[model samples]
Target: MLSDQIKTKCTLPHSLYRAQQIKDFEGEAAALAGITLYSLMERAGQACYDVFNTHFPDARQVLILSGKGNNGGDGYIFAALAKNAGLSVQLCQMGVPDDLSGDALLACSAWQAKQGVVEGIEQADFEKADIIVDALLGTGLSGALRPEYQRLIYKITASGKPVLSVDLPSGLNADTGAVSDVAVKADATITFVGLKQGLFTGRAIDHCGQIYFSGLGITKQFDSLCSSSVTRISYQDLSDRLTPRSRTSHKGFFGKTLILGGNLGMPGAVRLAGEAALRTGSGLVKVLTRQENQLAVIAGRPELMVADFDLNKIDDSAIRDWATNLVIGPGLGKDNWAKMLLDFVLASDLPTVVDADGLNLLVDKPAWKDTWILTPHPGEAAHLLGCSISKVEDNRFSAVRNLQHSFGGVVILKGAGTLICDGKQTYLANVGNPGMASGGMGDVLSGIIGGLLAQDLNLQQAATLAVCIHGQAADLAAQQDERGLLASDLFPYIRKLVNP
Candidate 1:
């Protein structure tokens, strides 16, 4: 399993940086540590070698595909180390040996000094190798791959061998995580220097299977040189926020959460959200839906208080006075009734969590409020941003930032690597799995955030903690099988995680 191959000894840093930041400040960081850039490269290569030995201990034959850059230099250094260690190692240099310069040329010379032969791509024996090391292109790639690189990448991918990528897989945008044409999909990736922000989101998640980080002994210096572009978080990091509740607390101490949605024929959406809120520790949970849905919404869940919502009557002030927190738009169809309820919820200063049709409604009305949190998947985010879904996925960090700027409050852009932005800082939650793609997941997430907000957590804290809890619940529920997992499977795990 992919999880079994992960390196648990190395702790990952919470701060993430752009590629340019690493390039610009890496030299100064090294200098501050009294080390040269080439020394950093050597440490990077050694880190990769250590990961390979630890993970692929049984493998004897290795193939290293190297380009004419620092990334390739790291590969050359690793090749020399492997050859000296009595492994059958073949180094395939992508570009001409004469084209190499600076530290790359020196690395190539070191490999040759160790009697390691540099072969061309044509001579690489993919079938004979137990593993392939991808050191081509690295994080410098911006546009589509060159024809030669593309052909090599296709050949390597088709080789059906376990692959380890150095720094990052080739053809992946270090800033956006988007692959223009093609990218190397590695079984494991060992990154150096600062952790690249792009490796955790969008298409990069599929390409970068298991990630290992190495700061090369200069991380503290490097991190001090510049501010990080993003923050990476997970359930383990945020679970402490769910501290022990007051021993003498009553039902009203936790605060009440009022959920508005479940239009005609859509009772299931509101039911799931209300239950998730209850599981997340909301003191009092209420669902205000169409009169016809009141029974269905509260059928199996007796804890939720169900009430009939009539658009014609529209007692907005009375409803606002009842709950401490509001959740709008689960199974809320884009109808006049849904619109009126959304407007009613938006009119108040109550902390609100908006998802599904509430986000779609905002695309037209465009209300910006500091007291609400907007959670949108890629499709809904596209609509809110007035762009294509592809555009939003192309650069999720940018999309989430734009969403926060335009809509105000905190914004959660949900996907493989869910991102939360609070206008000032951006956070990436690396907790969820593919099984979470099923229906009603967003509704559950919205409810979780609303429950946290109701419990007196601020917008950023509530959004970040809720996202971690929601995704971690899905991860636990999918441990047996991810293929047929349901959104409701997370309820038990959610209750357990919140207590931690």
Candidate 2:
């Protein structure tokens, strides 16, 4: 078994926290460390300025959109530094600068003292600016945008200016990844203190572009003091866990994977899953699809052992006996044929990756087992939870944890930030792209988990590693262009990551 070889614990580089959690962490830590708000504000601005200079060093003119609160405070600090550095800075105060207090007022005064006049929007020249800094709102944003902020945000967006947002893109919910009526679409975002939970998932990904982190000299303290809601998974963390196979290793050392799905008209689904299973290093892969689909599936990927389930000539006992692990789903529709095949697989004691229609069927039966991994997209999760898709999406972290509890196994909630939860721990995958939105993607994911399971990876290891592998492959494949990416395009990359 490869259980000893696989790493179940994730040492996340940056754990994700909610807006309030981060605030509390910063406040308590700053108090203990004797770090003043004024100095921290300076550090935030300094760190952001460094990253900005490295990225847009050639630019001479900058636009800083300042709002209320400490977010606006950071912008003022940045503008002061920029002006001092000989960059022409255009600072627009969305709110009156006189209203700013404490560190914010101090920052504004420093900028003014530097002869950097904070301009009104009417006086600001958008076309003259080389880069725009979004500081209209921060992690405190919720609900719809205020009318005045909306107009200003739209103006910046329409300018097609490369924007570097402060902390977060304004109007984005730092806790839920939900976007209000409007949010800043920045070219890059420099988040300070802690990595907000929202930045990695949902609509936040669309707004917070090319995310950069600046702990502002408080990263270690923040980590030690706060409990992160989710742990991010990366290939770098998992690479050393698997060493190169022994030269004398035999095929029998790896286990057999059985893939059952692809109802009559959907052979391609099963074929894609089966081929992916083979590519991911499963010792053997057999597809038990519909009778008519078997020949085409075999023709396309002959490495797979295709046994037509509907064909009475194939013995059920033999098919079940051949599998060391089972993958049930893909195009396994809700028809009688699919139900029959799924029931058989469900009855077996084999470890399984259940996805697509399998998850749909699971909604009705509502069973649980520690050995099964349930991969459900938002829609399927909604069905299982007996709620709206919006409800499932409104809180994906909660939904996945609930699924793990209800399913009594590993639950892989598939979406933007794919979440995997064994009863004991929850993991988030950061490797996928939007291009993975197309059809047959989940089928491939099911195959990967099942393939890893067949290799004797423990339930959590198999689910977590397979999720990362599936996402990493999709990301790699989408490099050419995510728009036209296909599920099969991930095959080569999937093979590469599994081996690495």
Candidate with maximal TM-score: 1
lDDT of 2 by residue, 1-500 (tens): 11121111242254788899988879777766678878889988887787688667887999888887899999998988888888888999875887788888899998888687988766768999999998878886767788887888888889998999999998888877776677889888888888788887777778887777777666667778998758788767665555688899887877899998998699999999998888888889999888788889999998989877754533468777878999999889998777787778768889988898988888778888878999999999999998998888877888888888888889998888888888776788877887988898988988888888877788888888888888888888988999978999999998888777
Error of 1 at 105 (Å): 0.4
Q: Per-residue alpha-carbon lDDT of model 1 for 1-500, expressed as tens digits?
A: 11222334236788888999999999999999999888888888888988898778888999999998999999999998888889999899986789789999999998888778999978999999999999997896967789999899898899989889999999889888998888999888888788899999999998987788888888779888889859998888888888998889998999899999998999999999999999999999999998999888778698899988767678756777889999999999999988899888777899999999999999889988999999999999999999999999999999999999999999999998899999999999988888988998888998899889888999999999999999999999999889888889999999999998
> TM-scores for all candidates?
0.97, 0.91
Model 1 off-target regions past 4 Å? 1-10
**Model 1, C-alpha of 282: deviation from truth (Å):** 1.0
Error of 2 at 360 (Å): 1.4
lDDT of each: 0.90, 0.83
- Cα TM-score of candidate 2: 0.91
Q: CA lDDT of 125 in candidate 1? A: 96
